[model samples]
Every structure is written in structure tokens, then in C-alpha cells.
Target: MVSKTIQTASPYLEGVYQPVLEEITARDLTVMGEIPRDLNGLFAHNGANPRFPPGAGHSWFDGDGMVHGIELNDGDAIFRSRFIKTQGLAEDLKAGEATYVGSLAMPGQGKRHKNVANTDLVYHSGKFLALWWEGGTPHELTLPDLETRGTFDYQNTLTGGLTSHSKLDPRTGELFFISWAPKPPFLNIGVASEDGRITRFSEVPLPGPRVQHDMALSDRYIGVFDFPLMMDFKRPDQKALGFVLDDETPARIALVDRKDESAAIKWFDIKPCFMWHISSAWDEGYEFVLVGARLDGATRHTKSGAILDDLPLVDGEHRFDSHPYMWRLNTRTGAVTERQLDDSFVEFPRVNDHHICSGARYSYMARIDINQPTLEAQGIYKYDLATGSRTDLKLPMHHIASEMSFAPRDGAKREDDGYLIGFVTDKQRMTSEFWITPADSIEDGPVARIKLPQRVPPKFHGRWVDAEAFRTA
Candidate 1:
């Protein structure tokens, strides 16, 4: 019997989201500027790179995960790319086609696949873990070569799964994360020690199943969102994991103690809004300050009212307006106050690695162009949290970039004393460039630009693993 071929109307199937058929390893790449000698580490970017075309009703989130990395040592850079080699990808490869439907597929219409491990990459406990945002077992990968080691289950100690945006406290070497599924005790919060041991796990009950994408962590507290956006299994018109902007559901925030399980988990009510990423969070006096991108409503369809899976391309109608905002939660009075931080359109926020669970002076994020056809960013924006000022690191016309990864210099003193690195794809040339810019002078352009051999698809989250991460492994 002849096998059927899949086709897709989704815009992600083409352009930067287009999948690369083969992997390549290149050494001593062409660099346009002086690579900082002190910048010694590996920058690994993880994204979706489907092996096969996802036919109708496919979502961009369904593609297989791929890691594109470059290692820098003493001003020298080497490039290597590889598929995450997840169980789902392996099964599909063995079948000679895609056996499982995408995240937006109708329930019971396709086989359920293992974790795609495509959304983000984190380095903790001396291992690089590739994670999926929708909850799954994180896949471990070795550095320098980007080899897939295997799945990590906390020595089979975890009662729940993992989130893509797990937080690692730089000072304590402890990892904090949360997990959620469509079942009772819908959320599970946990922490892992420096050596990858599950030390604390707690089942946080919620009213119902909600789409909780990211979390915020301060020195002493972990913040999880119970936003208004949730899954509606009764929506027949929208079959795939039915997502609806629930106005009736009140948005709330949950704060749990990072180290003490006996401490009460406090829940505070907030205005209805949606946020998919958190820039940073910290404690101040008696309040917790959380910074992130907030949208008035979920952006899931186009102006034509067509779902993302049915859209041919991402146009302005498909673009959702988002802005940086700061939320302050009072621990004593259960009072919540929020204010818009900036007016610019931005997302994929990042701060220095050393400031993950602490307060930072500045944040670097991708700036989106309103006229662009796709969500690909047009430049980088540096926001000063102290003065509410902004600096723009604009890219050349027709050029797009990825989320900035902040790499601090050796013996760096100040928080902003670091370099920002990320991939920039030039549509005019159909090529990609790896850029490095001083965290304080992003507007001055890259201090170094290493040319990539192939175009990397626009991806989700990545990390900058210092040399010490591998040394201790």
C-alpha cells in the first residue's frame, strides 16, 4: 500500500520554520568581529525543526526539537547542529513518516507521542536538559558536541513532569520548576538539588485545568500563574486541545516557599490577563516584584477569524499586542498592583544568568515589528527597570533575530557587565549570523558576528552554559 503524504496550511511550515534535512559540523567559523577572549562557554539554541511536513490542523508547537549550538573557547568558535533524538522523533523515523498528530490535532484522531523536547534548554546539575513547554520528561544532552544522552526522571523520584522554563538559583545551585496536566491536583511544584536529586515536591491544587506556560522565582518564593486562558473540552468547533479565553475565570497568582514545604502556599487574585514568559522576579520589603510580557487577550487567530493552523501566513492580524509589565504582590495584605513597564512590543525576555532569582538592573528582550509578516523579531531592546528608559538594537532591514542570551564576563562585578548573544537570520541572503553585543551597548550593534553555515529556524528558549558547567560534570 502507498503511504499518504501530509500537507499543511500553517505559516510555520515555510521560511525560518522550514526544517533542515541534514546536520553539519564546522570548525573555526568566519567571524566578523573580535570574539571576546574571556567569553569561554557554549551557546546552545533549541527550536522546532519537524522532520516531516505536518499536514492540516498542525500547530507550530508540534514540530520536533532541534539544537543548534556553537562553542566558544579562547576566541575560537565551532558550530554543530543536531536533532534532540526524542522518543517521538525516533518512532516517527522508524515508521518512515509522522505517526502522531500535532498539539492542535483533534483528540483521539492521532497517536500520542512522547515529549518533543523542543521548547527550551536548561543547564543544571552538570547536564544540559532539553524541555518541552507543554509538560514532558526533559531530555539530557552533552555539551560541546550536543549529543542526546537520555531522558532525566530525577532517578524515578518525580511524581509529576517538568516545564520548559525551569529556574535555577545561581547562588544556591538549586533548580525550581512546576508541572500541570488535565487532572485533579492539576499542578505540581518541585525543586531539585545541585546534584539532580528531587528533594521537595508538592501538589498544588487548582480550580481546573489551565494553560500555565511560565513561572517566576524570587530568592524565597516561586510564582505560578492561573491565567484566564484555559482549555475547553466542550468546544467542538475547536477540536485540538480546546483553548478558550475564559473571561469568567478569575486570574490569580500562587506563591510557594522555595525551600520550606511546610510554609503555606499563598494565592493572590489579579486582573484577567495572559503572559507566556517571565523576565525576572525578586523580593522587596514585604512585596514580590515580577516582570514579564502581558497581553490583554490570547492571540490565537487571525483577523479573518481563522485559527493559527488554518492561516497561510502570519500577518499583522495574527500579531498579538504585548508589552512589558511589572506586577507587585503584597504578602501581608494579599494586594496586587500592576503597571505597564514599556510601550514597545517585546517578548522572550532575559536577564543575566547570575540574576535569575534575584533583582537585576536591566533586561534584554526581542523587539517585534508591527508590520512584519511573521512573529520573527526585528531587533533587541534593552530596558532599564530603574528609570523606565529603553535602548533599541535595531537590525538591518529584512533581518530578524532570536532571543538574547546574556553571558557574563569572568569576574564580572556589575549585573549589566556581560555580553548578549543570539542568532540573526537575514532574509535577503537566506543565511544566519551569530551575534555578540555588550549588554550595556546593545544599540552599538554586535561586537562579533560569526556567520552560520545554515539558516536556523526561529526557536523558543536557549541557555549559555559556562565552561564550569561541563568541568563539574
Candidate 2:
């Protein structure tokens, strides 16, 4: 959608003042919702059957899944993992069986329509909570429906916003989630108390109505960044010219002063441009923030015009590595230093609030050894806080992963590194599996690969919920 304001040449300015100000006008831009239409013919069978396609081909909705948080409490495996079953349904439909709801396809490919919907189970204040980003209002599961113990709705209030990512404070046990408003286009940071009442709400600023894909927490402040949102409603041949190059852009980061809650606060910006998915950690008493930036500014919508030229593969030879950089943001001085990674870097960087696990989209085939025979360039680039050194391990290129969780080893303190758990996908099959790799040992293939019963689509973000805390027995 075009923004509400536009600027052009004006006769009121002379030489120096001419470039200083451009004539500005307000235009109402219409934005639409990307709602999924229900298809009558598709089957929703829960059981795995030859007739039913694997989770890959619309079995479970093709979208990201919230993680089954870390199992901290003692209990059986079922309650511990917090794996919510993907509800399945199946039916045969004739010509009129499926209804075309509308199109989510950008104006590009004749505007093809989207077919599925997504709803997820999130854990907050010690129980499983539900939220859906679709058209309907956000809903919550009742107390009787909760499989775990603990009080929710602390302030007897229900807070609603776009809940894509969240984190639980280890010390306070408070929940902080990233939310966004669709109608008015405002970002939000909401805090839910240990008892489940939302005590605070902070409005975060971003350029547009965007998805808060990733966030990192520090001892003093919460750092947030905005992800770019664009669609190709126009033909593929005309997509290159469809972007906003204006100078007035909105700021993405809002530094909330946890120390002074008395209305006076300060915010810091490392001046990241058109970036998405940031990871940060507190290492050796210093807070560091790292962000991934794509320079082209072109989005997946660019692929909508794929049929016109070449179909844009996810791993297409596009400008993936142009603006990717890793910066160290000083929490004390609010100063930032930088290092540039190879251009092809696009995967999410995993951090443990101390160390940054930088992954690169390149690999060496001969030197590194792993269980899989296939070559993997998507190696985990390890960074040490104390020494400031880096290492690379070839985990095999096909292992696409995100939402990495670091757990302490040998029942040590929560701050220590133990094991790393992440959801990985085998791109060939579009299948997802749980991987267990040591946080310190990058040399090993995930110690265990717990394969899912069916193909699971790639997901965005998740938290580690302690299983022991949710056991009914």
C-alpha cells in the first residue's frame, strides 16, 4: 500500500531552501488483510495415512510453529516437550466443494489466493496459551483446558496484539512479548506478570505494519527491530521499480529503561537499515546486539513475478549477502562496533544472551565430517565472548534451522552452556526434525535427531518451557 504522504517539487523554495523542503501531500492508501479462506475439499485427518499427504502438502498449516519450551520441571516426556498436536482434517469436495476466499498473492502472479490458516499454542505464566494472527479476535484457552499448573490473567485482563515472538525473564519469570497493531500500525511490547496479569504495555515504533520476527533481552533494556513488509501486486517485470526510496523513514529500536520506570528514559539506535531478525546477549557484563540486514529491499513478493522470468527459488542466486553484518552494541556507552560476514549469510543468528552463534550460508566439504553424507554450507559460526574468536562447523547444508535454545549442561546454573535444541528442516522433503547439539561442542552432528511423524513446515520463533513445571501427575 502507498503511504499516506507524498512529496514533490514546490515553487515556494529558492536555491538552498529548494532542496531543504519538498511539497508534501496526504493520500489515503488502502491496505487489506491476508486472511485464509476455508477450503471444503481438503481432508483434515489426524492419523498418518497414504491417502493423506504428509504434513508438507497442507497436512498441518504451512507456517511457523511456536517452540515447545525447555522442560525444566520433572515429569513424563509428553508434558515435558509441550508439543501441541497439529489438528488434521480431510474431506472430498466436488467442483463447488472449495470456496475461493480471496487472494493473498501479491498483485504479481495474477494474484493467486492463499488456502490455509494458522493458530498456535504459546506458554505464558506457566501454561499453554493460544493466539492466532488471522482475521478473528485472539482467543485464550480456559483454566480447565490447561494441562499445566499456575495462574494466568494476573491482572484479570486480556491483552491482545500480534504475538510472534516472546521471552521469559529468568530472574523475574515475567513474560515479554512482541506485538503489533494492524489497523493503526503500531508496535507493542507487553509484559505479563508471573501471576498472568499484564502489568505494562510499551508502544514500540517501526516504519510500517510489520512482523516483529525476533528480539533479544539484556540486563538493562529490551532491543527491538522491524522487519520489512512488501508484496508484488504488480507484474514481475515491473517489481524492481516498486519501492519507497523516500528519506523520512521510521525508527525501529525503542530502548525501554527497566531501571527508571518513572516516565524518563533513553533509546539508542545502531542505525540498522531495512533489517529483520536480531539476536543479542549479555556477555561478560556487557550487552551486545546483532542484526541481519538484506540490502536489495526486494521481498518474497519479487518471486511472484517468477513465472514471467525465472521462478525464484528460496535459494535463488539473488542478492542474499549484500548488507549482512554483525555489530557489537555497547550497553554501557551505547556505542556500536561492526564486522562484516560473507554476503550469502541469511539464516537467523542464535544467541544465548551471552554468546552469538553466527551461521553462514557457506561450507567446506572435505575438512568437516558429520553423520550425513550430503554437503552442508549452512554452518554454525561460533563466537566466544571472552576471547572474541570465531569457529565454523559443517553441520551439512540441508539442515535449515531457527529458534535455537541453549540449556545448561550437567544441571549447572542457567547461565552455563549445556545443550542446544533447534527445529531443523530437510529442504528436500520439506520435513522438520528436532536436533540436539552441544552448545560448546560444534564438532558433532546433533547428538540426536528426533524425527517428526510427518513433514513439518519451517517455523519462525519459539521459547523453552520447563516440562517439569507443567506435569499433571
Candidate 3:
């Protein structure tokens, strides 16, 4: 599928990060092992796959949003993939070319950039939404067939853009999310009921506009992070990049009551660092503790305000070491205490969906390879938060992996009783495979491996949707 000597202008357009040109649907995929009868759901993921050649100053982040889904039920599996028909991509399809400017393009004041809806994939209220971290209208994709349904606006009351990180509490069936923008009243927090009602949507004023990739939700509180990264708008002499990492400012977290609508939100300052994802958060007595894979500063841009070409690298290598750490804020004294949980550098931290609200003792994250150039993972790390020990499920070299999607077993009692599913691309072969392993046993490898019909490029986050969640679709 690829040659060792293949040459491309951009490293992103080569190997597993390269775009695929097919939309496919295949039934009865061949599996290496027996499919679990108790497993019934879809492991759906979204990615940025450019339909045509990217525009000038094209960062790896710029592309058409594509969703790949594999549905399992009654010991059978089906696979499907589709390009999310976002308004921008639809126009490009009609014109038979790439029309929009790249992500690093300079736009004048009050101008807007294109929304690819390419960063994350989520399921809520029987609908699968393709989301972009840049804060834009979410595009909806249907199940079973993987078809585009158009943009979803939270029953039409959603006024501003929605980010990719919307935390859903499985216990109460309510989704807690925040949206950030570059304009005044920069941040807005929203809570939606199980049936998709926007119950409480209010503006949370900030000192200025910032970039927040993800948020955390606990049983009693919602955590909205404020890092040193901020949007640098266009100027006459300078080209406008999306964001810049400012070391002069401090990082803070705004904690809001999970259920109380009238409670005041408080901001607690922490060390100046940035985290693209949060692991798990909970309330431990008088402390509100949150764990994440932390970096010294934002790695997406350099000190000179130029956007980095590689989304998962710094200076074509592992520029920063990210470790899983926990931060505890004293609710009464307003003091912050933090510590490193492990020594390994990893990211894309996730817990069981049920644990996202109540917190869990275990967390599954992607192990970032120190010598890698792309966002490829060398393995998956299962961290025991209770004992501060780590177990690894390492992958073969040249296998670029995605985030582990935890699929709970039917009527399961334990948290890690289900399967950990993910898609990995063989960078050397340019082909893809779907892997499923027991969540409880980290060292044991995949129980089942299915070769995908299409090559899948390395991309961002995804979640496991239960079989019952797609009854309406």
C-alpha cells in the first residue's frame, strides 16, 4: 500500500496520516477470534481526511471530517465509513476542489474560519455527532449506514459554537459541556438532559478568549479549564494562526456545581500548563481533584507564533514530556496541590463512561512514543490510580493507534469487565485493523483482530455507544 521510498511534501500527507479516498460499507467482516456475545454496540471515531488537496499553509488539522464505525451485535460485525457533509465540505464537493483557506490563513477582524467537525465523535440522544475542537456547529451522522444528517444545534437554542469535549454523565444521563470563542463573553457552559433538552445554558465570563480542548464532569461539579493558550487574531503585518501559547499567564480551572443552577462558579489558579484531555475527576472530601496528562505549555505552536505542522510532535520529535498528574484544590481554603501520578509520557486518557461522573480507580491512556514524529502510540497504558502502578499493552512498531474506547459488557457489575476497542493503522503497509482486548487484563493482547476494508489514518477521540442507543437510527 506504500513504498519505503515514497516522497511527499508534508510528513502529514505521508504514511498513516495520509488521506483515504473511499467511502465504504461492508458486512460480515472476518474476525481473528470469536466476537463476544455480550458485546453489542458501535465503536465510532471521527477524523480529518481531506477530500482534495489541502489549501496553502495547510496544517494537519485542516481536512474534511470523516467517521468510521464498526457495529457489533449477536456475534456479528458490520463496518461503514462516511464523510460528514459539513457546509464547508459540501461546497468543496460541489465545486470539485478545495475552496476554503487553510487553518493558518489570515482573516481580518470578525471573520470566520472553516469548521471541519473533524476532531471528535460522540453519541447522544440516539444521534452521533462529529465535532471539531475549534468550536463550531456539530455535524450529525446516522448509524447502521454511516450517513450524514446535517448539523445539530441542541433543538435550535444553541447560539454559539460547540467544542469537541462534551462530558456526559452516564448515571444521570445529563451532558455537561462548555464552548469557547474569541469574542466577548468568551465561554458558555451548558447542561443537557438525557432527552437532549438544554436545561441550563449560561454565559461564564472569562478575562479573555482562550482555547480549551476538553472539560471534566464529576458527580457534584463540572471542571472548565483555562490554560495559557489564547487565540491570536489577524493583523495587517502578521498572518493569523489559530492560537498561541502565552507563558506569562497562569492556568486556572473554573468549577461549577453539577446540579445547582444558582451556585457561583469559582476559579482556582494552578501552574502554567496545558492539557488537551482530562483523565478523571471527583470530589474527595473538601478537595476537588482532577487528573490529566499535563505538558509544560501548548505544543501546537512554537515560541515564534507559528503553527506546528505535526499535531502530535514538537520540532519533528517528542518536544514535551506529558505525564499523568493529579491536581487537588481545597474547596474551603482555595489552595492547590498537585503531584505526578506516573513517570511514563502518555495522552488521550479515558476511563469507563460510568466512571467519568463518579471517578474510577483505573484509567486507560495512549502511550506517546518519545522517538516518534507523528501522534502514533507505542502502546496503551492502564494506570491504577489507587496504587500508582501502571500496566502496558504494547503494540508492534509502525502501528499508529487511536484512543481506547471502552465498551461495557451487558449487565456487567465491574467497571473493567468489558472490552477495550481501537483502530490502528500499519504505517508501513498503509492498511488498518480493528483490535479488541479485555479491559481488565492490560498485558494480554487483543482477543479479536479484524482487518478493515479501508485504510484508516491516525486521528482523534471516540467513544463506545451502546446497542440500545441506536434504536431510533
Candidate 4:
């Protein structure tokens, strides 16, 4: 029940002493039920030695729900954002290969340490760049191989409290991110120019800890939002269960001119808003941004005294649950719209012109609006903007879907209609599901659904590899 793929280059903690592996019997470690139920069960059995683990810090890691995508370059260079684990404290540190000990303190002790899993990393321009949340700082590694580089933190201090999600602009080769602080409470949509400089960092006043999740960019402007109250680090004691029982906070979409950084960012008044993964595309008349928010709380079925109770709760009686909705954002007039699907979802969203695509859980569709909630199906769903129509393909109950991408059709660029590609799982058979669907429409169903020979467990995100690029290690 341990991971075999992860290997270190130099001497790690395993070198300091004889590394011992033991089976976790008696379930001493408290399970907060953060990971998806199906994924949690698989990890418990298969035991993943992911590059980064949750409960630690935040980074775009390769584990379940962690967003990682292939940044198309010389062929396909897979890029993932994750918090690199290191041994020792601030002092007494020697850099080399070290076995990652995720927990600094023992389980029984009150101070249970977690690894850093909140940041995002990218491998581009012959270097690995890491972005952390705390300071919105950037850390770079020139070595192509990850192990030899050794772990490091950001050198620059982010002006705001926390740096949320970051996206790379393909056209300009720049980076866009949001910087905000909960204490003083202000948000800014920043642009990191090609020279690795903060070209335009504009601050906008907003309420405390809106905690921007994902953003979409069009030719004219970048659309951002204040996410739902369901997930917030502000009050760890705040109950997630209550947030799910009934939607508490609403999501709002804001527009900012891509060219005019000096102009005050315009706020669009959209209603019932709670989205997670987002992407954007543009046409002549208007710009379209794909956003996945939520229509309702997660469907839960807690036993009278279930194992969930044993796990450490994030806050008061908060059971682990999430629901993300996919919508289209119109920046010109500032209108958010989407087709009404009976089910709820929580996956990243993408757009292919008039068509919007996203990964989904089928169980969400099974729940009757009038009936009580329970765990069931998890699949992929596609929505059309012009028709306000939806198509559902049921995968399985426990399939943990992380992210989705749309590959260019034929030799067309991202601007044109492309094939929709998604990473999915069939945990029951320990199989990987990689399917390609037509971008123009899914009414005819997925063009081709290929199940990989090896089990891919579940993952966070993926990027499309342009055909012309030369991608070899």
C-alpha cells in the first residue's frame, strides 16, 4: 500500500535513518473527509506517494482535485503546481535528496503538521517556476529534473496577503493572478509580464476574504469573482456542513479591462454565484469565459455514527462536500449564463466557442430536487450556450474528476473549435479514463473514450500538447 513511482535523487530523510514503513491500523490518523469519498477509499487501499499531500500547505499538486495541466510547448511538457516537501526546520538544513515526512509531529500530539500543498508550479522556458499562496511569491528552478533542484521558497514578497490562482497568457507570454488579504481585505488582478516583472498590479477594494477561486480571460477583459462561502480558510472553525445544508454566500463576477490597467475594475452583478475552475475564449461580437460554479450543496449520506465522525473536522460539524457549476461569462455587458442541468458539479470549466465543456459527477443528476441527498454517480457533462442545452454521460459513482481541456480540432488553434479531452477514473477496475469528445457538439456522444491500460488513480489538471511541439525528456 505504498507508491512506487516517486523517487528522490540525493539522500533524503530515508538516508538519515533506516526508513520504516508500517501499515496504519487502528486508524489513528483523523480523516477530515476533505478528499472525495471514492478517492479517499482508493488512497487508503492503494496508498499514493503523491509529490504533495493535502492538509500540508496548498500547491497545484498531482493528487485528487489538485489542478495540473500540460502547458503546450516543445511537444507536451506536463506542468503541475505543488508544494515541494523538505525536511528539518528553518535552521539545521542540508539540501539534498531527502525522504518527505509529511507530518512533522506525531498523530497523538496536538500540533499535527501538514506539508505545503497550496502553491502552484509550472515548467516552462527551461525552468520550473513555483508560486506560493502566502506571499504570492515566485520561486524558480532551472534544472530540468525536479529532484536535483532542491526545494526553495519565493524571493519576492507579494504586496497582498495571499495570491490565489494563476494563469499564463498564451498570446502575450505573461502571467495573471489575484492577490488579496483577509485581514485588511483588498483584491487586485495582477499581471506578471514576460520579463518576470509585475507590469500591472491594480488593487480593488472588496469585502474580507472573498478568496478568489478561478478566473477567465477574454480579449477585452479578465473576469474574476468572489467565490462561495462553502470553502474558506478564514475560519477553520466555520462549519462546512452548515454551508452545504443551505447556500450561504453568493458568487459575483467582476470585469477588468485587459489593456486599461488604470481604469477601475468593473464589478458585474450576477446572482447565485459559486464557481471553481474557469477558462476563457473570444469571438468577434463578444468574449466568452467558461466558469464552473455550484447550484446546490454536495449530496451527503452520513451514517448515525460513521467513520467520518472519527476524522478531524475542519470546523463545527462540517462534513466534507463540494458542488461546482459551469457557466459562460460575457464581459462586454457583464452577464453570466449557463444551461440548467439537474445535477450539481465541482470541476474546472472550459469553452469552445458557443459550446461550454466541463467534468461532472453523475450522482448529482440522480438526486431528485424533492428527495433527500445521498452519494451516487460521477460523470462528465457538456453545455451549449446558444441552445441552453445539456448532455450527460454517466461514468461511475466514485470517479474522481480533476480537470478538463479542449484540444484544437485538426490543425486549428485554441480559438477555433477543437476536440474536448478529459481525465477521468473507473476506480472499481483500477482503470484510467481518457476520452476525446467533439467540441462542436456532444449530442452524438463522445467521439472516442479510451481507457488507459495502467491505472491513473485520480488527478488534478492537464494541458493539451500541440502536435508540432517536440516533447521528449
Highest-scoring model, TM-score = 1
Off by over 4 Å in 4: 1-164, 227-251, 279-291, 296-346, 352-377, 391-401, 413-418, 433-454, 467-473
Q: Can you tell me which runs of candidate 3 are displaced by over 4 Å?
A: 1-8, 108-112, 233-242, 300-320, 471-473
Q: Quantify all predictions' global Cα lDDT against the true fold.
A: 0.81, 0.39, 0.78, 0.39
Residues 1-473, model 1: lDDT tens digits: 21233644456777776888788888878999899988888999998888876633456776888999989888999888899999888888998787777655556666754488998998888788998988888899988789899899878876678888999999898888888887777888889889888888788778877777899899989999887666545545654554666655678899998767888999998777788888999999889999998876664532233454422233212224568999999998998999988888888999997887789779888897655656777898999999888998888887898787899977788898879999999877879988989888888988999998989888888899888778556
For residue 352, what is the lDDT in candidate 2?
A: 51
Alpha-carbon shift of residue 338 in model 2 (angstroms): 4.0
Best by lDDT: 1
lDDT string for model 4 (1-473, tens) is: 11122223311211211121221112122221121111100000011223322222211221211222222222222322222332221111242222222221122322222223234444333345544443334444332222214432222423543243466666576666777654544577777665555667776666545535566665566667765433232333532212232234455667777888677776655554444444443333564544443433321212221223332222223332334344556656767675443345334444442222121111111111122121122545565434456665544464634344555654454342555556555545544444555555544545444443334433333444333322342
Q: What is the lDDT of candidate 3?
A: 0.78
**Per-residue alpha-carbon lDDT of candidate 2 for residues 1-473, written as tens digits (9 for 90 to 100):** 21211111211111111111111111221112211111001001011111111111121122221222222222111111222222211121122122221123223323112212133334556555544333212223322222223223444564555353455565776766666654344576677778877777777655565534445555566656654443233444542222221123433455565546554434455343444444443333554544454333333333223221122312111122333455666667867676655434444444453232222222111111123222122555554534445555454555555435454444444343555555555766655455556656666555555554334333434334333444331
Instruction: Give the CA lDDT, 0 to 100, for residue 374 in model 3.
Output: 62
Candidate that beats the other on lDDT, 2 or 4, i.e. the better one = 4
Candidate 1 Cα lDDT to native: 0.81
After superposition on all C-alphas, the RMSD of every candidate to the true structure, in Å, is: 3.0, 16.1, 4.3, 11.7
